[model samples]
Target: MPKIRQVEIKSCRLETYSSKICVPLPAQNLPELLSVAQKLKELTPDLIEWRADYFSASDPKEIIAALEKLRAVIGDLPLIFTYRDYAEGGFVNLNLELRAAIIESVLKTGLIDLVDLEWQTKVQVREQLLQVARENKVSVILSYHDFQQTPANESIINILKAQQEAGADLAKIAVMPQQRYDVLRFMETVLYFNTHYAEIPVVAISMSPLGMISRMAGSLFGSAITFAVYGKESAPGQIPIEKLRPLLNLMSSP
Candidate 1:
């Protein structure tokens, strides 16, 4: 197998093909957002994800102001900006054009280290947003989520490849598993991709309670990042960061 590559952001280093815990902040207001960030700092998550879509304010200025406050509290910790659409189990409902504009505006702020863009976004709009992100020196994490069911291994692999081809610095896929084999297939696909294509980081998640093991054991199968919750779960199957941190450390230890 080829050697895997690591992604560095600020003082944090995400080691190649290893597990890094990410805590999602789903606050609806600035006060709540700062409170969450302050608390998670003690837990020591490798990355902090701001679920911007959940914020009650839709104005870009308000969102940026909130992010600035979040950055102040977190300091040098890597921050990922995610504005998930409603179709992908996100709380907020936004039109495609509006969503693209919001992401573009956020990328220009330079406060975030990584930005998460949905793989299903319109091609022209996606390219435009990616260009802006690149101009600002921000890494892009192209993501695909299936809240319904996990697809076949071939389909999963295709999605990962598509993200890489579309200029993503990291590729992420999260699927709901109906059976144990579905989770296994997801892991197998990730392992194959990481072993063969090591240029970009891959984040593979199998959602729902049945797939919790996938979250904990991601490092063994080449998943570079795993999402954990602190107070509220941004996704269906997230383990709390406090509990997940120790488990990930134990599993990833040499």
Candidate 2:
């Protein structure tokens, strides 16, 4: 890759070839969320993704309260607040409006460092949420999830470009890989894009066990972060951080 773009979140940088790991907190309630945080205090990953789609609380007030406590418990660890809707592997049937509201509310809390907003959200709503995220000084990761088979390689780059054009601080895609070649194609696409363009950080994941190598080697090809399981997994193909880290370290070693 020529010169790559960088997006900094706390101490971590989302530039090309950086191996950062994120662990998801997939707890369904405040109590569960807190307990997980306590365990994660020592075994911290680079970023903590609160998969809020799993949250039992629907009210923005309750959600914000939970975040306030989470912030206190975790101290300065950066948080990436995310709520994926059912169309994209989310937990509940939460209408888009409520989802947007909860996200906006979370951004205003000053407790989170970034928010993951799906790329397929209604155009108007997506733009509005982006604006709020900016005004609150929180970075936005414009994300897309394809539970089905991965799309063609060209389509993958197109989706990333669209996300960048839409003002994403980071652009991410997670898709299922039906065959080994699917994972290879996804990695090649990322390498090609990073070679040609110098813009926002990007994340490209190929889901399921067959696609696991893409997660482990993604950074070498320009994908910034690898999602690993902590107490639970927010997505498929994730390995426990304990196991994931050693492999990552070995790969990065001289």
lDDT of 2 by residue, 51-94 (tens): 88898999999999999999899888889999888889998889
Alpha-carbon shift of residue 221 in model 2 (angstroms): 1.0
Residue runs of model 2 more than 4 Å from their true location after superposition: none
**Relative to the unseen true structure, what is the C-alpha lDDT of residue 174 in candidate 1, on a scale of 0 to 100?**
94
After TM-score superposition, the amount by which residue 93's alpha carbon in candidate 2 deviates from its true location, in angstroms, is 0.8
Off by over 4 Å in 1: none
Question: Which is the leading candidate under TM-score?
Answer: 2
Worst 10 residues of 1 by lDDT: 10-19
Clashing pairs in 1: none
**Candidate 1 whole-model C-alpha lDDT, 0 to 1:** 0.88
